[model samples]
Target: MRLAPLDGGEDAETKPLWQRLGWMVAIWLVSVTALGAVAYLLRLWLA
Candidate 1:
């Protein structure tokens, strides 16, 4: 598959609302979990 450059933001209105929200929530959860892991490791290293 040929990869193309981002063509700006895709129109949100074109996608189903549930699909967009699901992606948002999934990404948010992943980011939060990664941050928590980093904080935990730092705390352990500093103790």
Candidate 2:
């Protein structure tokens, strides 16, 4: 069977590539900050 359709799908979003990339970077930064906070807390608990 064929994979993706040649034409844009009904459910596919129309947002631009740069907007998507910016959102990805913002999410990554938030995730990193959360991990750093957890690590700091764990270190304090162990000490």
C-alpha TM-score for every candidate: 0.72, 0.68
Candidate 2's residue-wise lDDT over 1-47, tens digit each? 65677456543468777887999999999999999999999999999
* Residue range with the least summed lDDT across 10 consecutive positions in model 2: 3-12
- Tell me the lDDT of model 2 at 2: 53
lDDT of each: 0.88, 0.86
TM-score of 1: 0.72
Candidate 1: pairs in clash: none
Task: Tell me, by TM-score, which candidate is best.
Answer: 1
Q: Among these predicted structures, which one has the highest lDDT?
A: 1
Which digits, one per residue and each the tens of the lDDT, describe model 1 over residues 6-45? 4434676689999999999999999999999999999999
